[model samples]
Target chain A: MSARHHPADAVLADYAAGTLRPGFDIVVAAHVESCERCRRHVRLFEKAAGAMMSDLPPAEMSADALPLMLARLERNPPAASADAPIAPPRDTRSLIERLPVKRRRWLAPGVWVQPIDVPQLPGDKLYFLRVAAGIRGLHHGHSGPEFTAVVSGALRDGKTTYRAGDFIECDTEVVHRPKVLAQDGGCLCIAASEGSLKGQGFLGELIRTIAGV
Target chain B: MTPEPSIETSEPARELAPEDLIVAIAVRADRDAFARLFQLFAPRLKSYLIGLGTTPPAAEELAQEAMLSVWRKAAFFNRSRAGASTWIFTIARNLRIDAARKERSALAYAVDLSEEPDAPEQPDAIVSGAERDLKVREALKSLTPDQVTVVRMSFFQEKPHSEIAADLGIPLGTVKSRVRLAMARLRERLEELL
Candidate 1:
């Protein structure tokens, strides 16, 4: 099913233009992979980018550029088979499951965190959060931007229910506690946040310590 | 001074569109077609990379690599699905991302991200890929000059929206709004025309 929530247009433009931070890009990709509407938007943005590229003033190539390219072509001729076999359709595993996670830390009775190994600057965090059904997460706000994509089940933040494939982007000013829906199965999400998350109080601090975020 | 005898000045291939040249390469293994394609795109790719902060030599090397990929991947080109320039631009963009990831020693994830199943065809998508490309180019003309400037800076130069606002001496919110407005306008215009 198509996602009800998607990343903003400006965010999609950044993703298409390849300017997004690596961690943020991955979360957006997970959403884009599941949402066809957003994928079309991304393709449109890419077309615009291609048009802009064609209009740029051409830079001069080195004097021997053509000759050098010809040499490389000669050394490595085009393969005999022009048509490669089609790639098999991807399996049903969630995006988080496909990634090579470094470790899984037990945070609470119904929750755990797995940090995905992606190159990141200090203060940046990218990981997967799995909350068992009916569990409520810590009340927190972000110091910078935080992006999340629901991989399975549902989460209730305020009035909205973010189901599988839905995208959520929260800025610094927003603070709220989100809970996994009681009727649905547990939820798994891939999230990338800039700077450390700001926990609200003592309980929040304890959850943060156990989650190590 | 006399002009050099470059492929750009040649008679038959000079008239072919970039798309036709790619088709020629795919159907016949035509070297001349490949040469024409290289002559048209390599320099522009280099200029693009340079704008994104790659050094001149590295940009030049990457441009060559991108063209080499075009040569190898020509058979996969589906003119009905995407314009030659759009396809080539994606190739170059992926190479740049790969190069950046290699430099950081990060795991290679960008390629796999794109490998997910393509969206099912939309019923309203009646326009061919080439027609869509042309319409998008026309829609770009409808945007105000200021909008165009931000689109170019943000998409081509890789400037963060915050940095763009700083460069333009405007508030950061204005920069984000301009981008959002410009893209919405483009999408609306394309829908109307297509």
Candidate 2:
């Protein structure tokens, strides 16, 4: 989408090593909410990390450390959260659910051009367009590396059509004109833009503010 | 290992041994359980900060701060979502933001250890506090170089794009792309392992 793209390798390593931040992790979580490409990437990294952990020699903790940790067990201690099935918040789920999960190139109604959901986010910038059917999306505009995915349906931007599971990246040099192409009612889309929209006209701004874009 | 003696009826000590118990005590607001939690997490917090590139003093202080949060916010831990190591990592990861915010220039906290020549860098010692953390370096090495850098950048500073740009000397957009790609890749990798 941009002059460059996020390397799949780096994300795998970071998540594997548990070095990523929560906010950033949330962004990635949002993307995983819609996109499978990024999901696959995360899965791969997890595997690699597990292998590494399995291979490394165990660190010898102080004798007291284990006892200390155990001694506290008799009391009611804090319970930590697991990383399994980390579901989206109710607001996000409700918004995404109303729209179809798997559409054939559907676009939200608005001025936004790219029609895709499932953004691999938390990088620098991410964009999401929550438009309804028959709504003219944002006019042709370019921003930083913009990755779009459909949380619901599909869309057609010029020749390159996008589907529910597809991932789209439109970088600084690329501007898109996206239109919804779903037959079963409509779709919901979630996109991540590297930077704010560029070259958006007055109409774009007006619509964006109106739609809370 | 002589599994820790069952709870002493006198003290509602339900914490310790398989970390689940630790959580149980933590839920009860047991101070001793909290101390145990502190003992377990304090060192990892320190190393994670070090990995992000904090000074020893700063890392120690930050680690202590994170432990205190565990003590205070123990109720928030959802064991069903993560186990001990991973959940603690999440806590430290969340707190890392606060640490980075303290210094405007901190991009995330990638401690090269070697970068700070004057500081006695104990790359292994710092990380060894948590056995799982000790494995992180190797796991990271298993990823592609591009993925590695972006993920590392995420940990180095609290500031999202701007600081990442400065620290890596790349454009803001590039950093974002890298993170997107990295998360996807990591998610995929972890899934395979599971």
Candidate 3:
């Protein structure tokens, strides 16, 4: 199936530009893996990113940069890192499987979180959140930007219902109370939040205490 | 590694585009051509890395790695898919990401299931890569200075939207709107070329 919702153009542009925080970039990548529309948008942005890089005024390099690079090229065959195991181009199952599944931890009675620590985003947070069917998940407002990409099942946050491959972005102003859609077998999503969660009501405070989001 | 003083002062540098240099290297495995490509892009790549928050020494290393990749992967360069500048720039970008993530999978941003580009209402099938690049350049020019500033800060500075808003002393909504407006215009202009 196709994605009904996708990340904003700014989000995709940042992703293509290689400037997005590693925490958010992976979630966006997973969504792009499954959404053809977003994939095409990202390609257009990639071209734009390339053009922008070309337009920047030149900067001085260390004097030995060229000589060193040339020497390396002559002495070595192309680095074999390109042949390293990349997530298969078309199949995302392999990519998802690569997540830290064995380390998953339960956050609440019916909620589980598997943290994915990206090296670049040591200060930020990325994790997989799984909520069992019929369970109302956390109700909270973001202290910073929060991005979520649904990988399996579905979630309903107020008026919008996000299904697999759907991308959702919530800023400080967006206070959402997401519930696992009862029809689906539960919901599994990879979420990247810029900072801490700011709980609103009493229930939100309880979740905040428990999840430490 | 021998010092090629002539290449440093060559007049052909004025006439040869980066795209031509890449094609030269791809077709003939020309060291001089690769050197020229290295001369043109390495500094810029280093600058880009520094801007992305990498230290100067680290940026230099990454730039060197990127150029090496270009030399070995020249034959894979498809002019129709990406221009030489774009290809080299992508290599540098990927190198930075790889260093940060320390994963062979860091280039996953370029990996997508759908290889086909979206078909627009008016199919511009004959548009060349150069033409597309020109269109993109023109679209960029069409953006207002405010929009352009916001876009640059977002893409080049690697600043979050909130940080961009703070740096420019503008409201967060304004920053988002500027980015949204500029991107919508770009998408409309480039949709046919896709």
DockQ of 2: 0.12
After superposition, which runs of candidate 1 have C-alpha atoms over 4 Å from their true positions? Answer: A79-96, B1-11, B103-132
- The interface RMSD value for candidate 1 stands at 2.8
Candidate structures ordered by DockQ, highest first: 1, 3, 2
> What are the root-mean-square deviations of the candidates from the true structure over C-alphas?
5.2, 12.0, 5.6
Clashes of each: 0, 107, 0
> Of the pair 1 and 2, which is ahead by TM-score?
1
| Residue-by-residue lDDT tens digits, candidate 3, B1-194 | 11122333443643566665655555555667778888777778877878888988898888888888787776666555566666777677777878877763443554732234344423334344456567778777777888778777766887767888888898988888989888777766666544
Q: What is the TM-score of each candidate against the true structure?
A: 0.88, 0.51, 0.85
| Tens-digit lDDT string for candidate 3 (A1-213) | 788998888888888778777768888888888887887777777777777776677778867766777677668554223245532454435456665443678777788988875553545778899899988866678888898999999988898899998999888799878989889998999998877888777866776676667
Ranking 2 against 3 by lDDT, winner: 3
Using TM-score as the measure, the top candidate is 1
Question: What tens-digit string does per-residue lDDT give for candidate 2 at B1-194?
Answer: 12332554434433344244445544455566556555655666665566567776676666655556565445555333333554455455546555554431121222211112212333432221133333445446566897776664554433556777887798978877777766555554444333
lDDT of 1 by residue, B47-153 (tens): 99999999999999999999998887777676545667777887887788778764321232333323333345455443444566677779889999998888788
* CA lDDT scores, all candidates in order: 0.78, 0.48, 0.73
* Candidate 2 residue runs with Cα over 4 Å from true position: A1-28, A34-139, A147-149, A158-160, A163-168, A191-195, A200-213, B1-33, B46-83, B95-138, B141-150, B158-194
RMSD of model 1 against the true structure: 5.2
Clashing pairs in 3: none
Over A83-189, each residue of candidate 1 has an lDDT whose tens digit, in order, gives: 45543454556455566687888887799889988666577889999999999988988888999999999999999999999999998889989999988889999
